[model samples]
Target: MKLKLKPAIARRPRAMMGKLASAVRSKIEMEKIRRRGGPARIRKGPPEALLGLRRFVANPRQFGGFVSGPALAATITREIDPAAGPVLELGPGTGVFTRALLARGVPEHNLILVEADPMLAARLRLAFPQALVLACKAGSATPEMLGGLRPAAVVSGLPLLNFPGREVERILAAAFSFCTADAAIYQFTYGPKCPVREEIMARMELSAQRTARVWRNVPPASVYRITRD
Candidate 1:
């Protein structure tokens, strides 16, 4: 008998067809990129020098600035517990650390990225649309910047050593004030030792210990965990 067609059975085939279409589309896109050059070929540089006059005006010692090595970036983000609340990333240059943080299970919505360079900030906003990206000086950021949100961890890519002594102190204080009591600050530096000098550490009522050394990175670098005693 010409009997019964169920609605569920009709829907199953359509759903399966949709899945097949998606898989085919993804494969085509991958092949196109591979045939070109690679994913890197599709990427573009910032529209302008993000760091601005700071790039030419500051001396090497005064800048203490280095984009974080990929290995070191992985280490810092790995230490972040996924269960922790939102994370605050300072001076997220070109979003190296920002990408690592996402790979480490921190949701994009839970990240607040503060970048001082206008060009870099714009790039970050485009690259990480899910993150709460802001173009502002780290030292000048207030708790309200996050819309009254409190971060569980602060991961900074800023060149702390290059900052003047007072500026460094102010940045640290502002970071600590916004962070939860148990929150930790992850910072990487190529300096001889921790970026936060002994005096600044004491004044901030914080202490830092080296967490990892990434020798494969350019000029090498170390990750430090600063926390309140």
Candidate 2:
């Protein structure tokens, strides 16, 4: 099915494609510089940070600031197995967590990035051409979106507390549907508790436990892995 975003958020016209092209070229150049053992110049903001900041400006209701740090991103994704079918990432933002998943041995083709912000989705497609990029709200997700592919693990960078309880439940239900019986949902939250509330987890027949805490983050964050058991 074709995914659509609110027209106001996807303000990118054909003219904006040029901006995407420039960003892609800059990313490639940075990679090449790293490979050559030369230091690349720093940008005002990292791609993921910039994407998050931009999206937040567009709609703070949809996004919190990007993942506080790359370490946090890598930490949340630590337990996922490479062979666990395709990995479905919720609110991948600018691919920060996506990059960590790839570095952890998850293949590019195994990734399915769901980004609500249309501009970020467009940028994600240009940045990670091999992965599936869907521009739709995570709460609107359906099992049909997976096309028979089951997920080994679902990693989320979504800020659930900013959303209503019902919306949170819907997003969790959708993510868990595509998971194997043993699959897990790894989610991070800035708040003290699990990102998805306990009652919602109970309603979905899922359980969660705190896995790690990133104390160095600005507001600190914790990771939780939800399971069917």
Candidate 3:
């Protein structure tokens, strides 16, 4: 008797075509941005332009609060205890801190990233498929968003002062709720003082102490280790 052969399984042409198109678009966009010196050009003459300029002036590597420098990211990551259970990185932008955390031996699976910008979030997801990436406001991160994942440390790249006082407090409160009692929260600011003011700190029942000043960074930056009382 002659042996029978099974028919080959066909792949979805549309799906495959869509993926190929996306890859091509991403590569083209990266090349364009690279030639322009960065990703995402700033829109000038708008009211937000001033604020964006100030942020950029403070940290040029971040491209107007879109990301943080690798050195700054490494320093912030180093502040967290190596034995910490997991790390929650807020506003991970272009995955600067995410890369730093991974370099410091934080498992990709152990990292949870909260990013607001859709473009940046998509890039981060592609860069770190193992990470739990959520595209949402930090303040709106519910327990479900966390998917039962608890973090041992919270590292923030959020422009706290740029946000409304109540909004900032809400985000910080939500972040703290997901952290352990002794969990450390590392934040950096270009301002002369800590970004979280006394009132907010008191309201959150948290205390912040400056850990290091990195003058080598553009406009200089200070790192604060915030913890619950």
In angstroms, the error of model 3 at 215 is: 0.9
Between candidates 1 and 3, the lDDT winner: 1
**Residue 2, candidate 1: C-alpha displacement in angstroms:** 85
Task: Put down candidate 3 lDDT per residue, 163-182, tens digits, no spaces.
Answer: 77888788888998898788
TM value for model 1:
0.74
TM-score of each: 0.74, 0.78, 0.72
**Model 2 Cα displacement at 185 (Å)?**
0.5
Name the better of 2 and 3 by TM-score.
2
Q: What TM-score does prediction 3 earn?
A: 0.72
Better of 2 and 3 by lDDT: 2
lDDT per residue for candidate 2 within 1-229, as digits (tens), equals: 9889778667767559889899999999988988967554323256557757777888887887474587797798899889767999999877778888999999998898899988778878877778888889987877787677788899998888899999998888888787787888898988989877778877778888999999987778999988886
Provide the global lDDT of candidate 2 against the true structure. 0.82
Q: Is candidate 1 or candidate 2 better by lDDT?
A: 2
Off by over 4 Å in 3: 1-67
Q: Pick the candidate with the highest TM-score.
A: 2
Candidate 1 regions with alpha-carbon error over 4 angstroms? 1-67
**Model 2 backbone overlap count:** 0
